[model samples]
Target: MMHQMRAETGPDGATDSVVSWHIVRNADLTALCGKTLSTAAPVQDATRWTLDPDRNCHTCGALFLREAPYFPDEHTD
Candidate 1:
């Protein structure tokens, strides 16, 4: 199956649930749903970060679900 590039990046902190996470396109800092953010936005690896449904961007999450984003380093064993 084809997958869309998704980068789960947000503020650098241990507080993952409260911070409004934005699903940006892989290699791009902008949100997948087109919500513009500052260039100084803290972007980190998806696998290394966490998210909360209630605090995340719904549009981006919906887009991500529809596209079924993939991570290259993730193994399916």
Candidate 2:
């Protein structure tokens, strides 16, 4: 699964963007699993980890990319 977003501002000065998630199935995983596999929800908090099986056929696996400023800050205490 991939988390994507586009930054935008509303007329009222509300700064926010709609988060979009994308999941692409892997052909190797399909062949291995012998069926179309879907992305399972994260076992733990998303900030900790995500289980995106379609991308990688394993447990507790995820791929994260920081492309834009749409994502929430991870440094806050």
**Which candidate ranks first by TM-score, i.e. highest?**
1
| Candidate 1, 5-70: lDDT as tens digits | 233334653333235566666556567778665555555544433334565667776777666655
Cα TM-score of candidate 2: 0.18
Q: Report the lDDT tens digits of candidate 2 across residue range 10-72.
A: 233223321222322321223122332222322123333233433332321232333222336
Candidate 1 worst ten-residue window by lDDT: 1-10
Off by over 4 Å in 1: 1-19, 47-50, 69-77
The clash tally of candidate 1 reads 0
Candidate 2, poorest ten consecutive residues by summed lDDT: 23-32
Superposition error at 58 for model 2 (Å): 9.9
Badly placed stretches (over 4 Å) of model 2 are 1-36, 39-45, 50-63, 68-73
How far out, in Å, is residue 41 in model 2?
Answer: 7.2
lDDT of 2: 0.28
